[model samples]
Target: MRYSAGHKLETRERLLQSSALSAKRSGFSTVGVDGLMKAIGLSGAAFYSHFSSKDALFSAIVERELGQSLERLSGQGNEDRERLERCLKQYLSMAHVEQPESGCALPTLGAEIARSDVQVREQAEIWICRLQESWAQILQSESLAWAILSQCVGALVVARMLATPDVQRTVLKSSHEEIARQLAVQRAE
Candidate 1:
């Protein structure tokens, strides 16, 4: 009953991807190890082989998700004003508001990350700071980078909180417009 050499790694990846999506859509604390394993078609007993504990899995998920977010939002070395604008538009869009499972982890997982242990929080901070640094390099203002980063995450959280789509859209639109205005001012200065 032996599996291939890659089977373990593949299963681990499947588990991580499934669990991260579940954690994003539902709160991470809400889902149990059995449920997380079940989502990946594995038994709860097998979970220990891939991760020492659920917390370890959580740490891995944060690292994977935030690293991905940094890459997407920051762009490669060629990021310019146009690319940043497009990224912002996508971030503040209705599609992002409706799709928490597939969007940025910050809006969905920020609270959980804040409450997590120091080790987990430190991992999150590393990725978050990397994201801010990339934007700061592009915008040439550390202050502006932090402001826009906070605004974008806050906008997504607020948009997700509203019950109606119209109100949600208004929140997104207002934030996007305000951010654009701020960016223009930064450019002018």
Candidate 2:
């Protein structure tokens, strides 16, 4: 049975979404194309119909996950300190840590992306820079913007790594407070 163009596109989207969730929950390299297609009720052969190769699929996932983050971090026309603070909170929250499949892909996939093909790394890098520049526009400090990006990703990574909920909260709260304080000091200067 043949499918319509629209049906094929929808199937591709479903595959991407399922792949993203699986990649975040499990490591990207560990989830085989065969398993992913089976999870979505499609045969492994159909995977090639949508993606030329698993590497291509990984590139697509990087694009999708980071693209969603870049869109969110871009914010409205107004790039104010308040908006930055809100972004920080959202990024640092326990909810984000607990739901790897639904949250930012940086901390989860950064190492893998670093080791991926140049195209995949570039996909992640371009979006990451966009996010940093967005924050820099508001902060009026490029160095601080880079620091903010690093700190958020680092804190979340640590928070997710620790097994204790209390430690996770402590990590989140401490980093959040320190970052807020830094911003306050920068504003006062």
Candidate 3:
């Protein structure tokens, strides 16, 4: 039986969401199209019916995931100083470090995207710009915004890599505290 347009759209969305979460947990390159389709309870044949290729699916998932990140950040409200501090606190929280699958895609997907297709790179660039912009708006200084984002991403990457929970917590707490101090100084200046 043929699915209607709406049903097809919903199916495609389901696939993208599942793929995005899976890609976060496992590197995007590691996830097979068949596995992703199976996770969504759809046949592998139906995969191409929505996306032209795996790269196309990756691009869609990146866009969707980035949008979700932005929405979450925005929901935290617009207090520049408070928002920047909150962003650091939340990003480096133990919960975020321990849960790769449910966390922001930037830290999880950055390495994979570095070796990804040009289309994926382009999408990543867009998300980076959006994140930078949101951060810049909060800090009111492009340089400071870039620094905070860099530090946050780097801290998360390192913390995630560490084998010991103590090391991970140390990295997260120290980095979060440092960023908070730096942002506080920026505000005072």
RMSDs, each prediction? 1.0, 1.1, 1.6
Measured against the true structure, the TM-scores of the candidates, in listed sequence, are: 0.97, 0.96, 0.93
**Candidate 2: segments with Cα more than 4 A from true spot:** none
Shift in Å, residue 162, candidate 3: 0.7
Question: Could you give candidate 3's per-residue lDDT for residues 1-189 as a string of tens digits?
Answer: 998999998999889888988899878888788999999997888899999999888888788887777776642464655665666688888899888888788899888778888888988888778878887877778888788788988999999999999999999989888887887788799
Pairs that collide in candidate 1 are none
Candidate 3 regions exceeding 4 Å error are: 74-78
Q: Whole-model Cα lDDT per candidate? A: 0.94, 0.91, 0.83
- Of models 2 and 3, which has the larger TM-score? 2
Residue-level error in angstroms, candidate 1, position 93: 0.6
lDDT accuracy of residue 4 in candidate 3 = 95
Q: How well is each residue in 1-189 modelled by candidate 1, as lDDT tens digits?
A: 876769999999999999999999998999999999999888999999899999999999999999999888994756576798899999999999999999999999999999999999999999999999888888999999999999999999999999999999999999999999999998899
- The clash count for each model shown is 0, 0, 0
Clashes of 3: 0
Top TM-score prediction, candidate number: 1
Return the top candidate by lDDT.
Answer: 1
